[model samples]
Target chain A: MTDLDLSALWVSVQLATTTVLVLLLVGTPLAWWLAHTRSPLRPAVEALVALPIVLPPTVLGFYILIALGPHGPFGQLMQLNLAFTFTGLVIASVFYSMPFVIQPLQGAFEATGTAPLEAAWSLRASQWDAFLTVISPIALRGYISAIVLGFAHTMGEFGVVLMVGGSIPGQTRVLSTTVFEHVEAMEYGQAHALSAVLLIFSFVVLLAVYILNRRFPIHAS
Target chain B: MSRLVAQFDVRYPTFHLHLDLDIPASGITVLFGPSGSGKTTLLRCLAGLERAPHGFMQFGETVWQDETTGRYLPLQTRPIGYVFQEPRLFPHYNVRSNLLYGYNRIRRDMRRIAIDQVVEILGIGPLLERRTHRLSGGEQQRVAIGRALLTSPSLLLLDEPLASLDIQRKQEILPFIHRLHHELAIPVIYVSHAISEILQLADRVVLLKDGSLVGVGTLNEMLTSLQFRGSFGSHRVGAVLDAKIIGHEPQYGLTQLDFSGQRLFVPLQPSAIGESVRVHVLSSDVSLVIGRSHSPTSVLNVLEATVQEIREISQSSVEVLLDIGAPLIAGITRKSLVTLGIKPGDSVFAHIKTVALNEEVTD
Candidate 1:
């Protein structure tokens, strides 16, 4: 602990955890809406969910900073500046990792199948009950996969966090940006240790998710 | 009052279907038709799975839909039970969970059906612990029925529930449905293309063809009508005659049944006398005679019959349909018809022997 520099490693885990939690809460309804609604505006809603996947992380981070700056709409309304703050790192991570959490959930919901849902509906269950009791449990594995991908993607983020966080000490500096600062200072040993830890941590998390997902038993009723 | 009424028309690329329906308040009313007759579309409409352009379905005070009133009840809100061709049991649930999925979700104030009785009636009690995928085709179907019945629906819709099963498997699950009809007052709108299913299960039959309604009647009328005769052909065409068992011979395993003051001998091997039995007489096995034949042969039912019409059945045989106070049909070779000169209004004897009449289960 004394030899290894972990100041930015702790910040990265915090940013990844908070961003995954927020995306899960927000992406659930968004993915469900995309899968269910058939209105003419469905295409527009789908485009909004997909925009993050195609846009470069730096470009997305720039727009997000403008939106959360002191004079920007949400920031001005909240009477606070979020850009280059700890809060800015979370907001940027959420925008960059939105697609990873939502797309898999949408596919899983689609594959959960319609027969069991319809059967539950015919059994006099309300729509909410049918989804909770029938549809959600069937897609539990999908949710686990979504959370893992979102967390892992946020952990590895570089451009978005760098553009928004601006490398504040003990505040917004994450593991990826911390390595950049160490490289610029010609401190190769500290940079190598942090980068290697990030790599191994991400690989373990993703491997554990996939192996656990494969081993979970799905009981056919 | 008509508890269920739906009139809708849908256009498809290959076929056009126009459906107008009014079913009874109780018992099974089978929607019978061949493959391309839009039977499933009608059921899906009733289930609210398909949207109808100009459709209306009402179950008592609850109005399911009326395009004029700008009201449509989705499948979740409607008090309807549906059993599809394949058993769509929740793959993640055990039998008990699937069985109670609807039962526990709905308000207890609306509960009218006894869950235990439904489990017992379908004979799925022992199977309640097993997973759905482990069950046989017959067991899966029974669970599907129980799942629907536990909903306590006003009307049940069955779309060819037994079409996927083989003969013996269908035979196994059919008795449970018959018991359900007797035990519960909910009217079932059954759909099937097999006439034997219509005979054994349906109290009323609504026949369809080419996406149009052809005939609607009881078992006797549908079996006797000329329109249905064309659908069933000469082979599976048979009459389900309700007769009182007069006597039974424990030795030769024969039973005598009386219908309209006429005695007929069948291999019922009835266990109890005075029990009601159903006898089927095929049109092909019946041989007609002009006068009283002196030959003492195996022709058990050589009763007097009047030739009503000489309908050309096939290239080689002409069906001599008879009405000897009871509807009877006989298919004879064209040579026999030409030699005997049998025409309409001629008296004859319909020799019916060695015919297959299965033992039917009736309440």
Candidate 2:
């Protein structure tokens, strides 16, 4: 596939891995708060988290690009170049992949029920400990599915990656953009090879998730 | 030295749970109530799972909650071992790790109960290697108990730990819990709706009915009292007796028990010599006679008992509760009472059938 397309593939992997890790850190607590909090602001917070999923990916990327752009509030406040860079790609991927992980995480949190949490609380496990030890472990199957789906979804992104980061070799160029470049250059054979490789990667990840999840905490059913 | 007092008012979406209770700091305290009667709510409040802005909970030296102060200790920080109705073991860890998850968190030199002892006490040795899902309902609960105990909780909160099991399974798990109550120094708050469970397992029972406190006392005091029957089904209605198993008569298929200087013959049970045993001499099983029956019938158990009180149970039946010193009640037909002139304070011999006796009790 054109000498393994090392730079594009490396950048894509870096972006996907970074995005998943950051989302896991940010989304774990967010999903937990969404699942548990009884505050009146919950619905609004949930809708805001889900906005990236409901709105077109290009729109989300555009807003994020503007917000993180040099003249915008975030960049002006932080004094950092966050648009059309590796960091920007990661940010855009995190937004695009959030609902993928958070939705499944919320489902898992809900499935854990109130009994165990209460049990852990009374057993002297702190809220953090209870969530980490009891709720997280029990809902681990859903969490794994979320991780795989989120990583795969970010890897396959086109519009968000394109908007936040147009083709910039080594710096921002990813597999999705590389394929677009191949198609534009009329390199159908290379495009076909790369597409086949991406299909295999997605299939393996999804299958591993399904098979492992079947034997996960809640059991086969 | 101080007692635990909990008085709480809870407002829910549909129902209100109002309870006033005092649980001492020793023995297994059972919250005996029917479903949706605020038994669990009371437990949660005691455990700090729910904070009603105005509820009051006092435990020994510490004040857990006082609505005016807005003082509350969250459940995780509270030193309480809790077992929910379900096993609720972590799926990621095998039985051993799941147990250690709590144990590892306890501060050094703060370990009151040893790991080996907990594993031995709950008999969770074989389960340590197996995945949580691979374990049976009873096994999972045993591990759950082990996990909770390892935490060295100040109070153990068990919300119907035996409810999920079948009759046979429940029977198997009860003795382990009985040992927990009798052996452990830590107090327990057990919530259950099963009258049979309360009879088998509780030292102190706080009875709840529709979110209101009804009765609180020893099981014996609760069982014979008129208030206790509303919790136990009418068919299951009977008196409980605390008796000392004097010895066994194998040839006669009877076991002899002594209570308040009265020697009573009961059916045989698996018991050690000089050990005490509780017997549920169902009121319905007793046929009272004014004079000691010298009839040579196959009725194996006959004891000289004095009637303490009598309550009308049904049209044809009268519940004659006896003070065999340790206390026993007999459900007899009104015809037997009137025709035989069975009255309170009347000394009589109670004829009990052999097969009616069950062996699973603690006196």
Give lDDT tens digits, candidate 1, residues B1-363: 656667778787898778787766677898888898989888888889887877787776677889889789888877788998999888788899888887886789888998899998999989989888899988999999999888887788998888888777787888788778778878888998887777677777888888777877776677777677667554556566666789987687788878777778888553477765556787777887778888787777777888888877678988777886667778789999999997898888778875555534221
Q: What is the TM-score of chain A, computed separately for every candidate?
A: 0.90, 0.93
* Tens-digit lDDT string for candidate 2 (A70-135): 988889999987898998899889889999889888888877767677766666677787878778
| Candidate 2: C-alpha lDDT | 0.80
**Candidate 2: tens digits of C-alpha lDDT, residues B1-363:** 668988898888876878777767888889987788888888878888778766998889988889888788777677888888888887767888888878888896878888888888888887788888888888888889988999987888899988888777787788788777666778888998876777766788898878889889887787777866666666656666667888999997778888777677877768776776666767667777677656676776677888888888779878888776656677778887788776777898787663234443221
TM-score, cand. 1 vs. native: 0.83
Q: Against the true two-chain complex, what DockQ does each candidate achieve?
A: 0.62, 0.48
Off by over 4 Å in 2: A1-5, A37-48, A51-55, A79-81, A187-221, B287-307, B310-321, B330-356, B359-363
- Runs of candidate 1 with Cα error greater than 4 angstroms are A2-10, A36-55, A70-80, A169-171, A186-200, A219-221, B1-3, B11-16, B60-62, B107-110, B242-279, B288-297, B301-327, B332-350, B358-363
The pairs that clash in candidate 2 are A121-B75, B277-B363, B278-B362, B278-B363, B283-B331
Best by TM-score: 2
